[model samples]
Target: MNEQHTVPQAGRRLIGLYPARYRELYGEDIAATFAEATEGLTGRALLRERLDLASHALRLRLRIASTDPAGRILAGAAPIALALGVGESLYDQAWYVEDVIRAVSRVATRPALAAGTLGAYAALVVPWIVALLCAAAGRWKPARRAAVLGLLAETAFWELILGHTWQMYGEFARIALLAALVLLAPADLVDTGRRGRWEVTGLAIGAGLPLAALAASDATVLGVFWQSVPALLPIWAFAVAAALLLAHLSARRPDLFRAAGIALGTVPWLLEQLPRRVPTVWAATAFVVLIGGAVALGGIIRLLRRAIDTEPAEPA
Candidate 1:
């Protein structure tokens, strides 16, 4: 009886490595499975079984953290990443503070530059404010639209005023876009009832005003394209592709969508590490594309297989 009881005890101890919530729900099942798997194993074989269980448990924990709706992992992660990007920019451009203060001080002397500067900042920040408010209130569509508007505002500011050079500010703006996408892609948000046409028009108007002002300020179409496309296209492609993919998967496999979003959120940091960590931008781009594509493909395959398995086995 002592020897027979020891195996189950050992299995329970190993299963404790998972989170309290997970253990509470699945601990008994895990221990029972572990005991069944190792019933007759001993020595090296038993050690291997335990190691496999440990590794599998860790993976399961990571999977839960990545995909748990209660956790809202990607929803929270993207904003934090954006905040970090902003903090990093502020640290690097500490002089931007003095410059802003000086700019404000000379509002009377250099009204045009000062007004333009202030306007640029306003254009950039206001939409972010709108997005955050909408997101906080669970108005997902408007939140996403507001974030897109903010990106356009930033693009206009860069093209018309900042000479179109890439900078950390751009990174922060992109991160904001991703955060909005994260909010918009959740399965619950996707299942919400259709929005009214007027609501859609209102969002369009809200986004358009900033663009129109930028155009009036001589942010030409050609210049905006030249400045924004190279930097923005890849991000746009990935964001749209991932959002659509996740939205589709969210209907049936929300865990997959959330997990994929969490992975997508890491792409920016991976890209950032390329210049020094990787030999070339091309290589880094390929690496990201390959890895992202592979993961997406694998998940899609699994979803398809599950769908097939669930379909009533045809008229046989």
Candidate 2:
């Protein structure tokens, strides 16, 4: 095939990956632009063009690109989700530290484990605090850098410092998903107007809740409260579900965008359940059922609202 023919062909293949509605509307123009952009380009330049086309198509299919409202909501929700996930991890780490302390009191010879646990906690916590501060102050570029560094530190802490034989594969997957969401979210959308303030507040609240729980328990001298840290995950998940249901029921028109954004935020917690040895299949099944039911419930509520709005009222 001629060079001219090959570029257009490659562009068409990439465009075909888009949703049918999207492809039908803009496919030809995108293909032509891709060809024009890649004309006379070769090696890395040509490869870069192709990759960009593919990435855009993938984003459109995912409905998480800036072009879609859903994308904007997801972008706005990403930082909040990141904060929640980090906070949950820190809460777990606090429990781990408590366990280590208890073990040391019993054995009096695990100084290394104690030191390693504290080191790992610091590695994860310090950078995440910086990220949260940067994000709150609207310094997104620095926030992104700090977030990435925090994740890397946590990964190293697990793989090198702790040297645990077993890995939490689900936790790793959740981390990767969080990183993608944070990196892919459009900063312009995430840091604009009232939405930005809400996002920052959500981040602070999401992150602060777990720490506050820890502090409350510690200060009150209540071992039961400390033991209840694990229960907070389920409580958070239930609260999100309740909020979605209430939003759907209470609104004249259900806000699917907000519901979806909330759902995306809870995904990290859902993912954390996946690697559990017991009830693994049940966890996966429950997640699918929960998502399916939410979508169906939203559709039903929308249809009902439309019907009510269209119905004629009786004359008195």
Best by lDDT: 2
Off by over 4 Å in 1: 1-97, 164-254, 272-316
Candidate 1 lDDT, 1-316, residue by residue in tens: 3232445666766787787787778766777678888988889999989976775566456653335563354543343233222222322233334456777999999998887766765666677667655654556557556666766675675567666444544344455555544443332323222432222223333323433343335454555542242323233333333443444344544555335544554455434322333223543464367446656666677778788879997696
Candidate 2 structure, TM-score to reference: 0.58
- Supply candidate 2's per-residue lDDT for 46: 91
Each model's RMSD to truth, in Å? 19.7, 7.4
* Collision pairs in model 1: none
| 10 residues in a row with least lDDT, candidate 1 | 83-92
Tell me how far the alpha carbon of residue 135 in candidate 1 is from the true structure, in angstroms, after superposition: 1.2
Q: How many backbone collisions does model 1 have? A: 0
| Candidate achieving the largest TM-score | 2
Error of 2 at 306 (Å): 3.6
